[model samples]
Target: MMRSAALCMALCLAMSMAACQPGPAAPPQSAPTSSVAGPPADSAGGATSPAVTSPEPPAPAAPPALSAEAQAQLDQELVAAAKANNVPLVSELIGRGGNVNAKDAIQDSAFLYAGAEGFNEVLRLTLAAGADVASTNRYGGTALIPASEHGHVETVQILIAAGVPVNHVNNLGWTAMQEAILLNSGGPRQQEVVRLLLAAGADPGIRDPEGRTALQNAERLGFAEIAALLRGHG
Candidate 1:
């Protein structure tokens, strides 16, 4: 009986060792394992699945540098501020070595900026500071062309009084007188301008490259009084 008991104990020991030995893991059951949990089950045994979330990409950033030409244009705006006689700004730019007569890429100088805006105080300061009155723009127009065309009669008068060429032509081949009449600029001052030109010995009959005369322009624009004046009519 004792021998029988010993054999039974040995069998129990062998069974225990066999249980500890790893067997081929049962192919993971179709059921989800602990590492990957499926969605929670609903009350009706239906499961709510987690949505697939994609990470959003970041937005693009601004450019890091301005081109050389852009830098030049910025410099031009500074020069314009000087021409406008923003005295503090002018002093700043000039202090920073800005050119007093710097022409834009299109050949428009700082004086043109002042004249175009009819800033008389700035105009006086610019000219007194040595801004060139005779500088032409890209269109070969002196500052007088714009001054007359835009009805800045006082500015025109100022330029005229300063000896600006009243007969100066632009790229379109129109002189200041023709521009005034064609654009109906110069109001009462226009008549005065005509008188001033005539008195200055400006031939009222001078024709454009298109063979049109200033008198013809005056007539076409229905300024009968002006036409009559030009024609020496009663």
Candidate 2:
């Protein structure tokens, strides 16, 4: 009975020692996580920001519109300026929407008058402003005819280069070549005009209203140099 009592006391002492020992320490706390996302990775595994672009520029503004009366007045002014060899006024009027092919009461357009009168500055302006090359004058002749007749060599060259038909027959049924021979004195300038005309494919055989060829007219007018040029071309 003494031995049994002693064993029970020893077991109760062991249970009391285990309960007195402290429990394991609590687990270590982790840091707080961020809410924001990081930059995205590229195919090469590099971080890339969003692409930036510039705004597009605005288009050019169009010219103002004009009424019929206002436009007609501008065209008339342009024609007068061109006829008077007023280069600055012609350019300004053209910029203001003046028609280069608009005709005056006498059927004289800025282009026609400038070309016929050898006004090269005005002619160039009118040409650039869209002069009608095939348009005729009061005489129903191209600017080249009068230019050739007057021995305006440079004017003739400019007109021809602008695509004036060299063999075009005017109302008088005379080509520029015939007019150069029949009207001019066949001086050095006239000879050069004839040369330019022939080079530009003016037909020497095209007859006038009187049914006379340019070469025949030149021979009759005693234009030896021009006749020689015609014969050489033939």
Which one wins on TM-score? Answer: 2
Q: Per-model C-alpha lDDT, please?
A: 0.69, 0.91
Tens-digit lDDT track of model 1 for 1-234: 999999999999999999998878676669656987778998899998777899899876633455777656655875678455686676555444444456777675666766665666556655665666777777788777776666676777677776767777788887777766777643676776566666655666668787989888887777876687788832
User: Where does candidate 1 have its weakest 10-residue lDDT segment?
Assistant: 91-100
Question: For residues 1-234, what per-residue lDDT tens digits would candidate 2 score against the true structure?
Answer: 999999999999999999999999999999988898778899999999988898899986655899999989988998889888999999888888899999999999999999899999999988998898989998889999999999998999899999988888888898888889998899999999999998898888989888889888888989999999999998
Top-lDDT candidate index: 2
lDDT of 2 at 146: 95
**Candidate 2: which stretches are off by over 4 Å?**
1-60
Candidate 1 colliding pairs: 186-190
What is the TM-score of each predicted model, taking all chains together? 0.57, 0.76
